[model samples]
Target chain A: MSAINGQSTNGSTAAPGTPRTGGEVVCDAMLAAGVDVIFGMPGGASLPFYDSLYHYQDRIRHVLIRHEQAAGFAANGYARATGKVGVATSTSGPGATNMVTCMANDIMDSVGVVYITGQVARPAIGSDAFQEADVTGISIPITKHSYLVMDVDDLPRVMSEAFHLASTGRPGPVHVDIPKDVFLETTTETAPDQVNLRGYRPSKVGNARMVRKAAEVINAAERPIIMAGHGIDISGAADELMQLATRGSIPVVSTLHGVGTFPETHPLSFGMLGMHGLAYANFSMRQTDCIIGLGTRFDDRAVGKEDEFGPGAKVVHIDIDPAEIGKVLETDVPIVGDLKLTLQKLLPLIESRDRTPWLDQMNGWRRDHPSLKIPDSPDSVLPQEVVRAIYDISGGEARVIADVGQNQMWASQHFWYERPRMFFSAGGLGPMGYALPAAMGVKLADEKQDVWCVTGDGGLLINIQEFNTLAAEGINVKVAVLNNAHLGMIRQWQEFFYEGRYMGAFLDNPDFAKVAQAFGLHGVGTSSRDEMHEAIAMAHEYDGPVVLDLHVDRVENVYPMIVPGTGVNSVIEDPR
Target chain B: MNGTETHTLVATVADHPGVLTRVASLFRRRGFNIASLAVGHSEEPGYSRMTIAVEGSAEEVKQCEKQLYKLVEVVSVRNLTGAPAVTRELAMIKVRVTSNERPGLAEITDIFRGEIVDVSKTSMIVQMTGAQSKIDRFLDVITEYPIEEISRTGVIAIARDDVGPRNGRARG
Candidate 1:
């Protein structure tokens, strides 16, 4: 490695014992990692570090969120939207604990996000001092790696290491819990320019032998299906995926997280497949001769009824993490490395071939049972129609986010994204109330990009408090609420499986327009289809954040659904 | 497996704080029923060797190896399931008997290559070290007599002297 300018490559240009506060060292490390923004909230234990952040205001900006959980989700959104390591910070105790769900969510999705948390003084660690919590202990299971900073000198190394591990192989969240006293303590030691951990290096290059075998399998596959995942986006390999797909004439189906990794409008693209997947997509899974899973874990939801999944399909799984290679499915070829590099190497080995018969079969499924589209009627509005209208009005270019549940499925089914990083949702943990805060993070990461948050009434209420954060931050994201009077997904299930026994599914939604008004933002509530279009347009035209509450049909279920405990092919095209 | 068969696992780990916690936590999280575990300094300066006895299915054992390798502190792990290995255990048994049965106890100890380390009017303590099965058989015979108590160290194993390290990449 060569020095950038006149800087020495030997590292540590600062005097050996120059005394600087640990907080300063941490801030210095963050700047070295190129962190421009940090999402967090200050409290008793983390106040010292927050104060240090004030001094670094010229170099880094801190965005204060209402809740620590949203801070985490926003960081997650930042990471996912920008393909950078997102970061969140909070004080000790409840502040640290509140970020748990988001940490777990990132871990499951393999999103790289760093979380810095404050702890009680070292001496007060186990004594239950005020605002003290076992943050590192609690986070060990949810993070790729966790650290409890013991020495002030170790802060710089820990920060650099956290960023390295979080952004490297098999990217996931990492937490660094610093004691309050450490931040106040000063040391003169200059931070190192690079980190060298003997035991922590991650291998990024794929094995030539495995890639060769995978290529051979790909060439031989007659009815091969290219299944992509979030890894494509994480590795910035959407173009590589398209290269292979177009080169080989292979059909593509995505896991939920892989939705926009490949353009849905492509001739070879089959949209998302699995539970609640297109009927044709599920049929392709059963009929394919080869299953090429790229950066996907073959999650249970993605491979419904595992016992009957891919009976004859030869499975080829490629991921940066070796742990996920064959953890779920019996893979014939397993290649471990960064997806983009591996795909780049493997693309040359691929042979251009035609699979007209397979394409014909999938085309038949696409035309026979298509994704639900909005009805042309001006007086009727459904959740599916709301998503479709937004898709139409945005020209499929706005960065789209959806909260979990009915609105999520509706958006995923209707919206056609043309590029990677254009769609964001809670795919792994599927946390509700994720859209509002996550969208804010996305908008912060790319202020010029238009962000649209498509959420449901139930999902919105979970983190409704974040609307204030949006208005306060002056983020101009569009919030489109697909307001139905019930937890629509659960209600749909009860109607289909439980004979319409609506227990604990009904929701008494407040006047969302008034709630948006209270937050000092423009709000429009409309139940008719024409009003829905007008409201979306008005919200888009508004200079600041606007909420459009769309009262959709009360009991519309997502179509092409795969009932639980059934094969992926056993999809219900339409529900009564 | 009736879920009671014994298997041996050898792992090399970085000699750092909380490494044992991470390795131990992994086993517990994976529902691996560990029968015995022993950790000691290894030949390398900054690494330790751990010998663990586990009873689980083949898949679980494979998973145990894979999961262990996933931990940064764990250098490598190998399961010595069927390969020839040297297994040993140490035990101390205290037996209660009269003077008449004392001679019989001494003879039993000699037959099993054990020794009476402690003796009293009511009891005698026998110390023995041997293969796990040998110790089990020895216990089966001694328990017929009136035994006050017994304690046994769990099994520890090493690969046969002829076998070199299976994979050299893990030898860091």
Candidate 2:
């Protein structure tokens, strides 16, 4: 099959003069859109779609996940990792509702995904039929666009539009809800050759005047820093970002999602910035004269106490979404265009300058602060060390997907990502139990790449049922459960903000290794630092899935923290 | 008008299902309060024009405009806040009035260029069409009598002459 405009041409499933089922039309559409895999589960409403899947299994590989939420996260993980439109599906009502959190996560993180949900029959849609839910209505706020297909003939166009909208500028999740009967209805329609949405044209080229203004700002700045964000990865502008940074001798600070866009090993890299970010990186915000915010929204987490953040710095905000510019902070030069194109235009005009004094100043701060220290403890292993050990063993090559909360911070802080899409986490929504299932998608996306799921005891248990799926599918993803036996982040907050009154922060965790073993996967439990490295190695060596549960210190908190509602200047380093 | 806390914005959008909900939801989610919103079919066959009066700072309203443009159904948005735009509202007030008091009420309606659309033995319904402020004044003048109910089709607006249609193009 030849490819044109990134879509495969082998889209027709029905022979000439033969009618095609709506489900087959959907299959043809997916093939046309170049969808090679889908993460989903079967249900009553989606039986016909599954029946069609049975026929098209040769072209599209379907992974039957344990839960709809896992299916959505897995699809999201696939999208984040590959920069393609990941697909997930489910039946009506409960199945559709289960995917809402993942949709929210995808939207928040700007991930491109297409969620195909089966609905009640068209006639029974408004009658409150059994297993029916208003999927499109529920998804309106969370998705980039949503459609409730009433006509079976519109399937091809809707599928094409869904993929187009999902993967376009400022990528986000697009949903298509189809009636159960519609999927079974016969049609001769084929996938559309083009998608024409009059109201949905995204800007690609930067305005020449604004790009010039931004270039002028960059050229004039004596001490400037590049705040690279998820947009860099989304637009595939990492090379452009590096060129701009290197040309101007500018320091680079990454938002959590922006990690790995610029190689952390580079001297210009200042590491992740925000709450739970590097102290030196957060501190650098105060002294910088210009903030070249590329593809970042300057989220509240990234810019703490917005009014007090970068009080004197001139902000040059460049984003594909016009709404994101000047939405959070006042931007001096707001460039609304694709980051890659805008940077290309801005680079040549940016005059080269040596910022040795600024670099030396940040280096001094890095020396003094020195975050990511592994505490020495004989009785319990530190989760930070576990992440460090994974980075060391994998040689910083594994795609590390971290579950939310304390474990997420530990992974972001310790593991140095050298390439884009190497580190995946629930950055915007902060959903727990994302790693295990997301890792499944990442590993499936690229079988040669080693994948690791670093999760906390609290987060791991949320989607622990996926161990059965892993065992059944034989996905070789290594898992590291940081078992603190508490909702570590909540506990840390309770100790600091709530005056030590722990309310529902403690958890009596089960033996995760035993749980994995019961699911027919390799499992190992390690409580001491001595056993941690060997256990990680054992999990890495296992051909199939393996869960290595590391019992870390119960009270250890992620530090270099900015107190909630505080500014970047007021950073609280590890007291110990 | 540019400095005013409340601004009026006009958006041209596709006349598609749930588009109104999407627009209303964007306002609610973005924390921008909508003072009034009037939507109807535009000169274009399949598109609708929405006149939205929102309350916020200039920057906040600008952000609201940008967010509205983010909607796939919304083709374009024009902030008619400081522009020379023709704006009007239609209001119907059903008031409790005696046969004797009806004469005075009729006079008040006539003074405001409004008409008594309906009249009963002890009640009268006045239909008024004008600027929001004119309708507010008419309501205040009629408040001397016992009030019954009020129905308002919120403000709808369009740019005046010489200001070309900034309807379809997205502003940076």
Give each model's clash number: 4, 0
Q: In TM-score terms, which candidate is top?
A: 2
True contacts kept of 2: 0.76
Superposed Cα deviation of residue A449, candidate 1 (Å)? 0.7
Per DockQ, the best of the predicted structures is 2
Q: Over the stretch A373-478, how does candidate 2's per-residue lDDT look in tens digits?
A: 7666666677888999999998899999999998998899898899899999989999999999999999888889999999999999899899988999998999
Candidate 2: Cα lDDT at A263: 94
Task: Please write out the lDDT profile of model 1 over residues A381-473, one tens digit for every residue.
Answer: 877877777888888889998899988887888888889888899998999989999999899889888899999899899889888888887
Docking class of 2: medium
Each predicted complex: what DockQ?
Answer: 0.41, 0.75
Classify candidate 1 by CAPRI docking class: acceptable
* C-alpha lDDT (0 to 100) for residue A399 of candidate 2: 94
Residue lDDT tens for model 2, B91-123: 999999988898899999999999999999879
Question: How much of the real interface does each model capture, measured as fnat?
Answer: 0.21, 0.76
Query: What local lDDT score does residue B136 receive in model 2, on the 0 to 100 scale?
Result: 95
TM-scores for chain B, listed for all candidates:
0.83, 0.91
